[model samples]
Target: MRESFYRYLMTKRDPNGIDEISHFANAAFFDQAFPKHSDDYHEISHYLELNATYLPSMSVFDEAWQGYLEEVI
Candidate 1:
């Protein structure tokens, strides 16, 4: 699930490369937080809220979560 979310984020990367900072930062956070496994949306959302400082906004994660759901479902 973590990798899927990361991949979803990558799909949103700006073509001109202006959003890479947030993109990579979120990826790194996901890597550290869920290195092995993570599939629960509430668990991931809560974790992000606890570490909100590391993200641009909850909407960014929400968008990725939506994308992840579309891909898997």
Candidate 2:
């Protein structure tokens, strides 16, 4: 699930543009945190809350999570 989410995030990155920096940064952080092996939203949210100091706001995560759900669910 983590791998899928990471790929989902990466897919948001613009190939010839710079509009998706947040997605790139979040993907990097997600890779580093190596978040739990669960797909539960709350569990991932808790993990991010605990370890995502680099994130400016949880809204970024929330956005990515929404997109991920749309893509995979």
Candidate 3:
């Protein structure tokens, strides 16, 4: 999922972003980023806060990912 999101972001958000994405993206961020709707949002934002060079918030990541899903689905 991380790889998917990374690729999505690379093409959509930051075209000039790095090609290498962290391997732990799925384990570290995916689940949190896409949880069920709740009044209190749990940042689900990328957990790789330290490694995120271009992608900023979960909202941004989610948008790119949703677009990617729409294309592939």
Candidate 4:
């Protein structure tokens, strides 16, 4: 799953082409990647932490999370 997600991340792009990442876009990706886990925040957090290597970096993932939250809340 982590490998699949790593491949998936490579395909992600921000439509606006500003930050190279879009929280709204990634939120959609999350749902697609982990449909069952989407409702479970703890699972999501754990998954990200465990698969942190699949991501560019913890900081990048964090920026995405924060960006998502900012737009959401």
- Every model's TM-score: 0.59, 0.63, 0.36, 0.43
> Best by TM-score, which number?
2
User: Model 1 clash pairs?
Assistant: none
Please, what are the lDDT tens digits per residue for candidate 4 over residues 2-39?
Answer: 22322334345566554534543454455445433243
Q: lDDT: which is higher, 1 or 4? A: 1
The lDDT of each candidate is: 0.60, 0.64, 0.40, 0.47
lDDT of 2 by residue, 1-73 (tens): 2455656666666545554445445455456664534567787778778876655678877887888888777
Span of 10 residues, lowest total lDDT, candidate 3: 35-44
lDDT of model 4 at residue 20? 31
A best-first ranking of the candidates according to their lDDT comes to 2, 1, 4, 3
Off by over 4 Å in 2: 1-3, 13-31
Runs of candidate 4 exceeding 4 Å displacement = 1-42
Error of 1 at 46 (Å): 0.3
lDDT comparing candidate 4 with the true structure: 0.47
The runs of at least 3 residues in candidate 3 whose Cα sits more than 4 Å from the true structure, single-residue gaps closed, are: 1-3, 13-50
For residues 1-73, what per-residue lDDT tens digits would candidate 1 score against the true structure? 2455544455565545556445744454455565225556787778777855667778867766776787765
Q: Who is ahead in TM-score, 2 or 4?
A: 2
Pairs in clash, predicted candidate 3 = 32-44
Over 1-73, each residue of candidate 3 has an lDDT whose tens digit, in order, gives: 2334444433442334442233223333444443323212133242335444444454555554456567744
